[model samples]
Target: MGTHYEGDLRVALLDAAVLALGETGVDGLSLRGVARRIGVSHAAPAHHFGDKVGLLTAVAARGFELFTEHLAEALSGGEADPVAQLPLLTRAYSEFAENYPEHFDLMFRPASVRVEDPEYMRTSGIAFEALRAHLEECQRRGWRGEADSAALTSAAWALAHGIAVLRAHGSLARHYSDPTLDAVEDIAVSLLF
Candidate 1:
């Protein structure tokens, strides 16, 4: 029998999974690895999560929740103008990536793990909804162009995703010392406008 902790093992396993994923890519993540990291037997994770994919799905869901919360907080803060808000969002994203590098990797890696699990889809949808709401606010303030709102939103997401990916890969910092999310937002906004 697997040892039980005082709190929820599922949550603990998910946390361990994120750490393992951050340290190693998705391909390197294993239930046994997470279990060992958490000081449990190899089969402990299987008790909490059926398989490796189950653990990954849980981690992905948690990642989306964290991402949504950070983005929402950024939008709520009035420290900057709309033009500046984009960069703040980008910065928040980059900060999240840096802080939770493992979650960041799993969150964006294409086809590395299945996200079809209901919990994963639901959490992912929440993140998308939060982004859409932010985009709607931008539209309300006349920050967008004649482009369709959905298209504009998609473009903004793509721009942010691209920059975040570059930043994560160390290409942006290595290639440009002055690289900042503001610089990226400026280029995106200028192109869109």
Candidate 2:
């Protein structure tokens, strides 16, 4: 008898892809492997995603959606002060990276996924705007100096991204004496802002 999969195959495939990416990293993930892991035919992933890049693009899109939700929830749990919000947002970004390293990795690697996919574009924009809105408010209130809001937003994101990437890749622990990502993240954020 042939294997059967009920529910949404697309979602199942994405979940399998995320897990496979975690195990093999991006370079080793394949449509056949993802399908095989889920007991689906080898062509299932390609049918839904067109190719490996398409599957990765879908993964990146889902990552952005989850990422945006993470940021929104973090900001909403705190006071409205933009200055106060930075640490929360920074921590949330890093936490997302730590919690979803595979998604985080694929989300930032532009060359690995389709940049023009509508879902990916929309979700990623929402994630960026979450920080952009906060930075704009900070600039308006003179809380982040006189630098342009765009530059300030990008700088803040870059700082958080750098920390997250380093931690994800295990380089932070190798180079720094800090015993925890939180401690290093706090120090980095406090130093600049």
Candidate 3:
């Protein structure tokens, strides 16, 4: 057997939770399952997470962290028009979903999981704030109107999110003969700009 090394059991539990949630979703997630997948005893996850909700809170938190990181990287290319950056970020969002299907599913699916914990809320806020910061930059650059930045950001977010949802569900393939992220982003940006 391999050597057993560990420091933060919480981190281990979170990692396992992400894998389990991604595979089976919230309804199918089990503390024992996570523990087993990590090669630990069935009781191990409960020792660190207290319960399933705690474990999911950690998973959602990590997902938001990753989402924020991806968005930030997508926006960092220093394009002259931050509005142009919108399509890039949108593509990045969809790419993240395609690459991490489970994480994407858990992050957006309403019925699959419920993360009402305050810590989860705070973590989710990080992703929202990242997007809001970009929108604020757009307003500063005169790309946006004097209207509410929050509303504008929400609209843009919805556009990207809708495209991602359709693509993930294989719905876009039905309607749009060629539903590439670049095409989706191009159409969305053209409509906005």
Candidate 4:
């Protein structure tokens, strides 16, 4: 029997799942493990999330929501010029990845979560659209030269994602200081514009 969870069971399960993800990763995460983390019966997570994939999909969706917030904040906090905002957004992306490693891992691993899940699509789309909108603005102002905005957005995302992944895995820090990394990221973003 599941213990009575007085709070929002769905949110509780998601929180426990994130902790479980940090410990076990996608392959090792189980509904039973998440439930156990919260002192509930193993069936509790299944009841809330249908199955492991469903649970992971929820985690990914939540991750995207948070990721979008970070990007939006970065966009608002930076200069009005879209070209100038690229580095800020890029820094936010890396910071998000660094701060939320488990969510970051689950968000990008489509094989681990249902990419077709509507909430997943909506939240992830919002995050990407923020970047796309900024890139479009840059194109409109001719700040990015004649490069196709769509391609530029993709390149920008790739660069930021690459840096995040490299830093998360300790590859970037092994070779570069924080200032050096910032300089490298600035140079890379400069190349895009």
Candidate 5:
């Protein structure tokens, strides 16, 4: 098996941070604990991340990068059907949150990330722009009843983000249960259109 001790410690540390986030929330996340999880000395992560916030910012940045990629994929396949794309786009958002719970949590919580950081801002903007573009297309095609594309975009994002947050925290399970994440995702995606 590939070892966590090898290759890139920076990547390994971020992965460990995500795992730790599942065990404990943002306040409980620690650089030292991440290092120990990866079989490295506690001080090792400091070389790349200086501190916990720095590390989390990196993780959030990665999350946005992945989120943007998934969003782009939704827009691909030579389909001009904006309405049809909504489910794919939102599904991608939901999957990113569910798949990378730690990064997803930090991605939304400003306290854990340095929003002023250029890389973080740019990465997040990519994802935002992708969503905006789809909403614009929907508006242009009159697929949505309203001409206010911005509101449409915000509403769609709210639905996806709410589902992501609720699922990540297992809030949905506490109230009503969906047999699986996929089932919940399908229900959430259907809500978009």
Candidate 6:
């Protein structure tokens, strides 16, 4: 029930912040708690991350990077049909949220971290580009949607992100008999395409 973090304290601190966020939510998260989780002195996190917002911002940045990586991998999978790619992308989005719920929570909650922070700006762009690129590909493939790529991508992200949030917080549990997220994502994306 605990991580035995080795090598880098910064990594340990990040992991600890994520773990704390998942267990306690944003209000309960603090630098001291993260230090306690990692068996470090209270000053350790303060020195490493400066403050609570700073620590959570770092977590958000990492979340965006991880999310983008998974999304890119899903896009690169052997699904050439643009319509077919929606399900893959949905599944990948849910997977990232499930695998890193703490980071996911921090990434979406603007108050926890500065939404305009440079790290967040860059990393979120990377994540958003995956969806935008897919929408462009769909357009090029002769999909007759009139909306621009930005609009399409925004809608796609909203649906995918909504599913991930629901699944992460168990909101989907009441509706779906199957706890596995893939079926839910497939069904949801099926409605869109």
Task: Give Cα-based local distance difference scores for all models.
Answer: 0.74, 0.86, 0.77, 0.84, 0.77, 0.82
Q: Candidate 6: where are CA atoms >4 Å away? A: 1-6, 176-179
lDDT of 6 by residue, 1-193 (tens): 2344468999989988888887898899988888888787888888877899988999999999998887888778687797777788888888888888788888888977988889888998888887788788878877646778898888888888888887777878778776576685666666776
Q: lDDT value for candidate 2?
A: 0.86
Q: Which 10 residues in a row give candidate 6 its minimum summed lDDT?
A: 1-10
Query: For every model shown, what is its TM-score relative to the native structure?
Result: 0.86, 0.91, 0.87, 0.90, 0.79, 0.87
Candidate with the greatest TM-score versus the true structure? 2
Q: Encode model 1's per-residue lDDT on 80-188: one tens digit a residue.
A: 5565577667667766776777777777654755777787788888888777777777777877645587787777778777777888787888876756655655555
Between prediction 1 and prediction 4, the one with superior TM-score is 4
In candidate 4, what are the lDDT values of residues 116-150, reduced to their tens digit? 99999999999888888888888888876688867
If both were scored by TM-score, which would come out higher, candidate 3 or candidate 5?
Answer: 3
Worst 10 residues of 1 by lDDT: 184-193
Ordering by lDDT:
2, 4, 6, 5, 3, 1
Clashing residue pairs for model 6:
none
How large an RMSD does model 1 have?
2.5
Give the Cα RMSD of candidate 3.
2.5
Q: Which structure among the candidates has the greatest lDDT?
A: 2
Clashing pairs in 4: none
**Which regions in candidate 1 have their CA more than 4 angstroms from the true location?**
80-84, 180-193
List, residue by residue over 97-185, the lDDT tens digit for candidate 2: 98998899889999999999999999999989988987888777778667877888888889889878887778888887772756654
Q: Work out candidate 2's RMSD over C-alphas.
A: 1.8
Better candidate by lDDT, 3 or 4: 4
Two-way lDDT contest, 1 vs 2, winner: 2
